[model samples]
Target: MLALIGEALLAYVVIVAVQILINDGLFGLAKVFVQRIRDLPGVDLLIGAVIKREADSFLRQIDSKRSPTVEMSIKIPEKGISHDDLREEMKQLKGEEVNLDDGQIFAYVYTAQNEHYKAMEDAYLAFTDTTGTGTEKGDTDHETLVREFLRAFMHENALNPIVFPALRRFETETAAMAADMLNGDANVVGSLTSGGTESILMAIKTYRDRARSLFPHIKSPEMVAPITIHPAFEKAAHYFDVKIVHVPLDSDFKPNLDKYRQAITSRTILLLASAPQYCHGIVDPIEEIGNIAREKGLPFHVDACFGGFMLPWVEKLGYTVPKFDFRVEAVTSISADIHKYGYGLKGASLILYRNSDIRKYQLFAYSEWPGGLFGSPGMTGSRPGGNIAASWAALRAIGQDGYLRMARRLMEATLALRDGIERIPGLAILGKPEMTAFAIASTDSHLDILALADAMEEKGWRMERQQFPNSLHCTILPHHVTLVDKLLNDLRESAENVRGKKAKGGTAAIYGMVGKIPDKAIVDTFIKQFLSDVYTCKT
Candidate 1:
């Protein structure tokens, strides 16, 4: 026993040395090391200690710079705080948040004019049941349907659709509208989800279940997707116990069709393509992949969560967009966010199947529970009806004309931004972005892209930092339409400012190390620790 224990300890030391010595970022040294010693005694503890040391170092650096937070009680208050006092506190707290309204933020919040925001606010509050009103009749006008119908059904629970048929109709109509926009015939059917992640989860779960029923031999079902496919799919795969095989992209940032086709196997249950993938905003060759899926007899899902609400309009505006919806016969399902380009409040997305037969797998039903028979079409029970109503309202109010206008304006801004970036001496846009989202990279090594991002941050611009190749992601929105020229000027100056400097710290240094780290486990551990630390109460 002592000899075996000493052997395990030596193996652990060797594994740690391998991690430190590996120079190639793509080498699988850690994976091999872990595979060999994973079952050894104390190996888990050794790995845990390394993770803790790294996490503690990063957290201390962050903690040292963090501003003092507002005092928060760990326990429930003994007495209710006054509404006015709470509102004042909220206002003060919000004062520290980034001002997205200033058009300096390129990610997270997406907003149009103040009028549209007001409409969403009104629609949301009207359906929140705070006003305490019963059912009331309303006209069929779209805005009226949003305000009056939502007000009438505000007290209704969406979980019991039979009792609240209005919510049922709202959800059905919303799905149908999305289907039609995606070029699905009457055969296409779907359900509303909380957001993109839930939509993706439902799609993945449906396919996994379908595989279980149809191909029981596929005990360990796998999904094949481009590496650039949204992280939501990764989350879904993790949650559903599905292994995902990632295909690398070409120089153009689009998936290599041959590589993608080769990734599929007898165990592969689903093939995923993205309509304008998030990182580089490049749409995969969906038609080609759809054809491949058809030939392979596999289910194909298009994650249009980022572009579904905008691509149709973009195509209508005369830009060449590759076919990516039900129009491609092999596409089994699609997930799109209504809150994004649909101009709705958050918490609304649609997951559509080619037909009801396929969608049935997404539904969950249980009669064994003593709480009575329960059937849910989505992951969540007791979903908010307000989100459904507001989503429908946003789509109805926007119509095709409004969307086309927004699409045109956004595309114009995107092209102008692209042109401006290309004109800059050391900056270049990565990939041919099919939509308003794209990544900016440093063409010259001397100009550190992340350093440029930090300079932009100093100038009050919020940019999303991306890895796998350090770049800055920009998502152009309606609010960004007027800020294009100013943004270009700042970007040009920032690129110049970052010209010969190494990114020593801040987001640059962190993301730089993360991108270069060969063993992704270290990055994963750091990120998990960061997430836990951020949510913790340091007070």
Candidate 2:
């Protein structure tokens, strides 16, 4: 009787556990339902508040502290600070920043000696006005010259045909210059954007709107792109409520055309290919992709933001670059950055369309409000006239001949670096790079490339680490031309130092762990923590 009672108690415990599990499952389902409900339009603010509350509650439960911090209260000051004080503060802040002028850093900044920097400074000082044309902002004479020269024509919006006619002309001419460089026909037209990301965003949003108008049945619009495509497309899809279909790459790092074709469906509204993708710097199989798009009646956009400004010159310089621009039949649009290889100001990029009809979708216009008619091309309302002016100036100053020379210098530097890297025992270039940017990875498992990267970092050399094959990436900027040999020497020494060693600390360790983690969410959490630490407020 005792044994039977014990068995009965065991059975009862098992039954209770099963019941608990079912309740937990039901609770999880309810949470998902609530999340979907929160995603409804016009409830974003409420959802944001709810999420913040829940996040705070969870943090408290586990003792997690994550928040954006400020140096002090953001309220208006009763007293004004002196220019000397402001200058001192800025100097102190910048003292902690990386020295980009040294050409040691490989990422974030693109510097070409000091002339470009000086030019940018001059332009900035000249157009620092908040008012239309007056010195009400109280800037230097140079700013006055810049304002009087080009900025005075910038009357807020590019949509207004009456105001800022010269601004429109500047933009139109800039677009034409870029279009001609990309082998665009007479129909090709585009707009200067804030940057590469904005250019890409504009292209994606344009295709989304175009699809919506033409194929109204595509309620859940989708975009198809290679796995090697930039993250801007992902961001645009997230913002615009479009689904993304990522196609896997082949062994050669190009998008597998078969996989891309298979991934397409009735919902797919757009197609994308990148010229020299940022990771490995391999251009996608764009012509083949274009052929497919032509057959499928889809709008194909080539993201040449990385190579747009340089590739034209590269091809002209006699590099066997594959066809990727408007010359292709199915290619409907392209996004190229003038700021990158063009050596223009930081906030300059162009998004071009094959015809005005497609470009029209990217523009926004509204006259329904009491504020009267308001219209704008691309993104942002009060577009920065300074960026446009600076870009125009840079292009005029650095003519195609100048760009060709820069491209030539970079290509020579790239080849030298690639040759040096190839000569290393356990290092290899990721692909046959067509441009100045390329990746080098560890060929032997014994050599820890991440550790090598860390060692190189210790030597004041900034090398960007890549995943999958575990590599180090560098863009051969014009500034880096003279340092190619030094870079290779450092890389060789770093590889020797870190051979077969564990990257136990620093960025290498962080990246090593990140590379191994199959679940990306944990890495994302760690990133969030890092961000929180970065923003830790003294107050």
Q: Pick the candidate with the highest TM-score.
A: 1
Q: How do the residues 1-539 of candidate 1 rate in per-residue lDDT, one tens digit apiece?
A: 99999999999887776765675333466655567796799987798789779968976775465353444322113233333443344344334434445677543234474798668766766554211110111212333334443443343457866444446656887788888889998888999998999999999999999999889988899999999999998999999999999999899999999899889888999999999899998889999998899899999999999999989989999998889889999999999998777766556799999998899899999987997888999998877666676665556555677678778988998999999899999888998888989999888979988888888989999989998788899998766878999999999888888799987788777877777889999999999999999999997
Off by over 4 Å in 2: 1-161, 532-536
lDDT of each: 0.78, 0.75
* Local distance difference test, candidate 2: 0.75
lDDT of 2 by residue, 459-504 (tens): 9988798887778888877557678889989988888888888777
RMSD of each: 20.7, 19.7
| Residue 365 CA displacement from its true place in model 2, Å | 0.9
> How many residue pairs clash in each candidate at the backbone level?
0, 2
